[model samples]
Target: MFSLGNVRVRTKLIGGFIIVSLLIGLVGGLGVISLKNVGKKAEGIYSQNLRVVYILTDMQANLERVRGNMAELIYVKDQAQKDELKKSIANDKEENTNYMSEFESINISDEEKKVYEEFQKNITQYRSLRENVIKLVDEGNFEEAEKQYVPIRKVTEPMFISLDKLININVDSAKSANDNIKAINASSNMIMMALSIIGLILAILLGVILSRDINKPLQKIKMFGEKLANYDLNFDFEVTRKDEFGQTGGSLVIAQNNIKELVKTIIENSQSMSAASEELSATVEEISSKAINIDEAVNTIASNMQEASAETEEIGASIEEVDSSVIVLSQKAMEGSNNSNESKVRAKEVKDSSKKAIEESQIIFNEKKNRMLKAIEDEKVVENIKVMAGTIASIAEQTNLLALNAAIEAARAGEQGKGFAVVAEEVRTLAEQSAEAVKNIQETIEEVQKAFKNSIDTGNDILEFINTDVHKQFTEYEKTGNQYYSDADFVSTMSENIAAMSEEITATVGQVSEAMQNMAQNTQKSSEQAEEIRESVNETTQALEHVALTAQNQAELAQKLNEVIQKFNI
Candidate 1:
């Protein structure tokens, strides 16, 4: 259920390497453990199983030597030679006793112990019969010594059978040890292979998922960029992943919508220009006919100029009064301009302070984000958690294996092993609990990492909003103040211009009739220019047609690009 979409690419790469390292470590650990088990098996054979067989075999050989020594005693007549033979037989008896003591101390099975008891009973009988034969020989009763020797030799048959059975038990134990070592080695290989395969599959799956996440968004952005280059702004950039590409694609979509609005504004302005050009072409024809009749209106203009000259004298007095009032209005306008300038400065100050605050907030937020990312990248606490989890898992595995070995050994001990089996079971239970705890710890760490990532993302979203939205609002507020100051200055300048124009009108009233006669002459000249204007209008119409064709082509191209972009989910 976990998704790779929101996960950072850097994390994916690091996780991939971590998975590989864990795999190699697990395989290596398994190899080491298998080698350790083999070593223990070899050591067990040498310390117990093989040792038992060697001791019992050596006891059998010593008994054969005792039989030889007993035969030598029956034939020897010299007392000194007889004492030497008796001493050799006593030495062999002492060695057999030592071998029997060593054999009894070993932890053997119940069946092997029964066989050992029978051998001990028969061996005691043989030793007693040999002692009787030796006493007879010492007293020079050769016939009685020979009869006791026959009985001594006969007693060894059952003893030899018991020795063989004891040796067989130890030999079988050695064979089982060898088998156990082989089983451990085989199981280790199989487990290692299985785990390695599973690890590789998981790693590959992660890589593929990461690749898909990256490639899908990248391809969308690439196509979106290509379309943008062609002036296409209608692409559906719907990539909603929380990773880098998603953010970039979302920004592109916003830019696209903004550009589309700008282009639409441009198209509207072009249409307005086309309409104004059409109106100008219609007015040009009316002006061409009106230019010929300018003489008729000149008389009317001359009569109005005389009336204007009479009124100009009265206007001079009114202009004096109006100029004073205009001066006062200009003074007030200047005051308003100054006030606006002060307000603009204050607004700029507020804007700068807000911008600084936003910038500082961004810096602090980025610094914290970087620190957290650095900690995660540098493996600060997460590394310790991973190491601790790995160690716990290793301990649990080793403890479980040890418990199983102990259980096997206890079962081999028969009734004496029941308590040890219970202990091994308890140890195994504790090991399983440790393994489960490690699993829980790992899961909790994963959840913690996800939580940390979400926190970082939320911080990023807040910072982005402040920079892109809040900052723009402050810029607009500053612009409003600037516009207010500009309007106030324009009002002051316009008032001064109107006062100067009033005086210029009083002087020019006398020359108005003379100016109209000159305009009549210029109007006659405009008749000739009107013909040229008509021809120019025709050329302008052709240019407008070309512009309309270009706009149509552009619209078609935009449509095609939109269709292509619409296919992407972004």
Candidate 2:
């Protein structure tokens, strides 16, 4: 069934207002119609009835004036006075005729028209009689004019009666018009009053309907909201209407049911979680014990690995020392080889120089002896010998300069120039010796002639000794240098072999040391891993304990929630 309760509030209010407004409109419209009708009837009465009455009254007044003028015509004897009255009587009759025309022009009913026609006939008779009376008066027949005028009373009497009747018709019609106006006014007042009452009733009914439709459900929803605020879900609110309030109340019902179910589920889950938390606490303890044992074992292995690493480091250090010693011996052998080779080179160079010196000495001796003998035969031997000594001294000076230049070049050669520098120093010494011998020979030139023969004999013995002893000493120096070079070469080769072996041993020791270090690092990492595992187990145990506490709290909260939920009546 369609119900007003299910109707929208706005629609209800609007329908109620429309009904009241329509009633008001009807009331207003009826009043306007009634007033309009009254105005039309009043206008009809004024135009048709009142105006006719006005014209009839004017006609009656004209009759009276005509009657008075007729009497005046009878009494007056002056011709001028009679003429004046006659003119006045004629004007009065003309005015009455015009009034009759106006009366005929107005709208009237058949009965009013009949009565007006009768009045018109009687007034016509009265006017005819009045004219006869006036004609007699004008003829100076006073007696007869008086007699004629007396009969006018008979005509005017009925004429005035018809006039009064006609007037009364209009009066009666006006009265009826007033009565109709009164009736319309009375009916319109009644209808307006009825409509007013109906509108008021409708207004009140609409107020009641709107207020009840909105406020009843609103108050219910408000109460429901208050209960929900207080966490009371036990209040049963059913949606009885399809209005806005009903829909909102339905939503609240759904929310309360959902919350109730959720609280129940949480209670059950809390119980399960509490049991699981206890089991997990025991498992965490067992894990912590095993983690501690593994940590101790890893620490023991790490300690043994550390000892092995230390021993490997010691062996590496010993091999390093041996390698250092081998390096030093190899360096010494290389130095001996270089020095021997230098000596052998110097010996070879000295031997070649000695042979050149012997040749050059013999050529110089023969040439100087021939010059000396020639200078003696010319008694210029002393001067020539002195010149030769000076020449020799100059050569020695130049040789010393060359030796100094050689020494400078040797000095620039660094360590390799030590042998060359020694050789240059010997050359400088020989140059100085040559210079001294030149000085002595120059001082003993006279004795040189005396020793010339002995000098020939000494030269023979010197050449033989130089050719034999000097050549032999040069050869022996070359041999000894070769031997020293061979020995030094042998020593250098042996020392290199020893150094290579030592380096190989050192590299082996280094590899062992590195392996040991890696093993120790692995052991240390294992120990740290064990420590981390133990710490993680301890942390996990702590976390489990926290979780257990939290679970217990959750269970308690769930129990409290169940108790709270019991307060609701959803």
Number of clashing pairs per prediction, in order: 0, 4
Per-residue alpha-carbon lDDT of candidate 1 for residues 1-570, written as tens digits (9 for 90 to 100): 576777777787788889878988998999998999899999999998889888888888988887887898798778898888888888888998898889888888999989988987898888889888888887899998898788877789999999999888888889999999999989999999998898889888877877887898899899989998875665677876777777788888888887777666654465455455556555554554464355335445545554555455455555555555655655665566566556656665665666666677668657866775775675458767878898999999999999999999999999999999999999999999999999999888878778767776776787677667766765675566556556655655665565465446544543554455455445544543553454455455455555555555555555555555445332
Model 1 TM-score (2 dp)? 0.42
What is the C-alpha local distance difference test score of each model? 0.75, 0.75
Candidate 1 deviation (Cα RMSD): 51.4
How well does candidate 2 match the true structure in TM-score terms?
Answer: 0.45
Task: Judge candidate 1 at residue 513 and give its lDDT.
Answer: 40
User: CA lDDT of 473 in candidate 1?
Assistant: 68
- Alpha carbon deviation, residue 91, candidate 1 (Å): 2.5
